[model samples]
Target: MTTNPERTIPPTTAGERAMLESWLDFHRETLARKCVGLDDKRLREASAPPSALTLLGLVRHMAEVERHWFRRVLAGEQEAGRIYYDEADKDGDFRVSESDTWEEAHATWQAEIARARENAAGRSLDDLSAGGHRDIESFNLRWIYVHMIEEYARHNGHADLIRERIDGATGF
Candidate 1:
């Protein structure tokens, strides 16, 4: 299937909102563009031992990662369900059920990213919330930005290897 091109930064002066948006768009685009052309088998194929680092799994996991931080933590929405929380201890996102298809994984991820983009649209950098009164003192917004980059970077690394294993494709 044809994929949309990478998301671009909105033209603006260098500011905190722009920087946050750039990072968010960068990671989402990285995953979508990097996983292009992978077939169902390749998307679900396990990369190594212990855990399945399939591109499909990464997509699902990244969607959860985005929702966990953006909706649950930052927005203080306590009702958001954990991704695959219904599967007990097993990594259901990575397990790839008999009915699980590449299209399902891709659609789920894209929907989550779209939700996150909507969430980002209504906020500014200076708007601050302390998240909670627990021992952690960092700002809520900072955690959101950092976690997005960290989750994307880790899974994108998995995508790189998974792509290479699929057909010798490589690059960021």
Candidate 2:
């Protein structure tokens, strides 16, 4: 029943961006690993108290968050909305149905990650900051990479406990 300590970031160097991406990859892989062997019932099981922090909902939510930050914001598509965002009901990504399958959630998240990787493929940290006539906040490509990595790291922490509680499994 011991909890792992937080990650200690190493000092940055010439390939700092690459290093950040590596960390991001590790966290993403850890998150995916957390959901491994989980069936639909377990994926949707709300083990956390008073809230539905199911793996399926976390998958869907991360997909939307990735899309919102990378596709919409980074690509200068202000009109694009978060997945399932509406005035009628905000946070729709979290509100899962009983019939929601793990496969569908996994697919959606993978696609979103693919799109984000594509958007960042040819560009360096320098290109990400080159905002010309864009209304969204301009950030260095380095910042975007760091921020996203941070987001994943934070969410992965939550995922760790949620996954463990569902089946008593832990560790990356």
Candidate 3:
């Protein structure tokens, strides 16, 4: 299938939330672009040696992350279960299988991204989550956006290397 071209993130943007969301969306598109045109086998290929990081794994992980922060935390859904992974196998999302397909992963990721956007639609950056994970007692929407941007930025670096290793594709 022909993959869509990556959307450009404006170098200069107005407003704090716009800038944050734009960068986050750019990084999200970058990760998707990295996986574009690759089949399930290519998506599940592990990086060199000990790391189990794969393009598909990254997509799954991000879906969980988006859900966790937006739906669970921000929306105050403490009972929400994970889309991937469990207490028995916390890293299950990163553990690929022959049965796992790119279509499934991509669809889940897109759905979670949409849910996250919807959950944050009318919320203000100054709005705080009902609760926070672990040491963080509470978190504001602004913090979540910034954290997600950082998370994507770091993972996109890994994605860049893995994509190149897979097919010599480079640059965003």
Number of the predicted model whose lDDT against the real structure is largest: 3
lDDT of 1 at 50: 66
What clash pairs does model 1 have?
none
What order do candidates take by lDDT, descending? 3, 2, 1
lDDT per model vs. reference: 0.70, 0.73, 0.88
Q: Candidate 3 at 143: error in angstroms? A: 0.2
For model 2 the TM-score comes to 0.82
lDDT of 2: 0.73
Clash count (model 2, backbone only): 0
CA lDDT of 150 in candidate 1?
A: 80
* Per-prediction TM-score to the true structure, in the order listed: 0.81, 0.82, 0.95
Q: Tell me, what's the RMSD of every candidate?
A: 3.1, 5.3, 1.3
Error of 3 at 150 (Å): 0.3
Q: In candidate 3, what are the lDDT values of residues 36-137, reduced to their tens digit?
A: 888899899988778889999999999999989988888888887897799999999899999988889889989989999998888899999976888887
Model 1, which residues run further than 4 Å from truth? 7-13, 128-138
Score residue 7 of candidate 3 by CA lDDT: 76
* Candidate 2 lDDT, 52-164, residue by residue in tens: 77777777888887787677766766665677456687778877888988778878787888887877777777765433223655776677777788888788888888888
Candidate 1 has its poorest 10 consecutive residues by lDDT at 129-138
